[model samples]
Target: MVDRDRDKAAESRRILERISREADTGGASLVSRATKRARNHVSATDADQDDWIEQWGTRIGRVLGLAICVGLLVWLVMFLLRGA
Candidate 1:
């Protein structure tokens, strides 16, 4: 019985090792393919695109900030008016 148990454990270990190696290989292949696709999608003039994206991001941020401030002011005024 002890020998049988030891054999079973050894078999399990071997199977687990095989699975680990397969997963590692598959993950590496997936990562390589994804990296290649990403590199191909990006162009040489990405700097120009990045600048425009940054400008738009700043504008959107400012607008959202102003909106939040206005909303808070309106809420405060309404609360004060309700108590008055």
Candidate 2:
């Protein structure tokens, strides 16, 4: 009974290992590749690097986006309160 349990465990491990090996060889899917491309496009460079222009541009863009969103929220609240 103990040997049978051990054999079953070993077989399970072998099957999982083979599955992992095959998945690694299969490569990334289309959605993953597209997501990776989009991520790369959004960021100018890695955090460790020193690319001042791109970094500052990204910061400014984020600030502008926040300001626009806030303005829209204020307008929405005013519109709702006024009941027009």
Candidate 3:
């Protein structure tokens, strides 16, 4: 019975080692494939700055427009309250 238990433990260890090796190989392959794909991908470096500038300009315009609208509303309210 003791020998049987020892054999079972040894078998389990062997199976675990094999699984570990297989996982290592598969993980390496996946990483290499992902790296290769990333290397082949064309990142948009040229348009990054242009996109940022355009977005910033749009935001500034929106803020300015909002400020003007709020100012006009406030002025109109004050004028109406002043009875002309």
* Local distance difference test, each candidate: 0.72, 0.77, 0.72
lDDT for model 1 comes to: 0.72
Q: Once superposed on the true structure, which residue ranges of model 3 sit more than 4 Å away at CA?
A: 1-50
Question: In candidate 1, which residue ranges exceed 4 Å CA deviation?
Answer: 1-50
Provide the lowest-lDDT 10-residue window in model 3.
39-48
Better of 1 and 2 by lDDT: 2
Residue pairs with colliding backbones in model 2 are none
Q: Write the per-residue lDDT of candidate 1 for residues 1-84, one digit (tens) a residue.
A: 999999999999999999988677554677798877554434323334558876566556666776799999999999999997
Model 3 residue 82 distance off true place after TM-score fit, in angstroms: 0.2
Collision pairs in model 1: none
For residues 1-84, could you state the per-residue lDDT of candidate 3 as single tens digits?
A: 999999999999999999988677554677798877544332323234568776566556666776799999999999999999
For TM-score, candidate 2 versus 3, the one ahead is 2
Off by over 4 Å in 2: 1-48
Best by the lDDT measure: 2
Model 1 worst lDDT window (10 residues) = 39-48
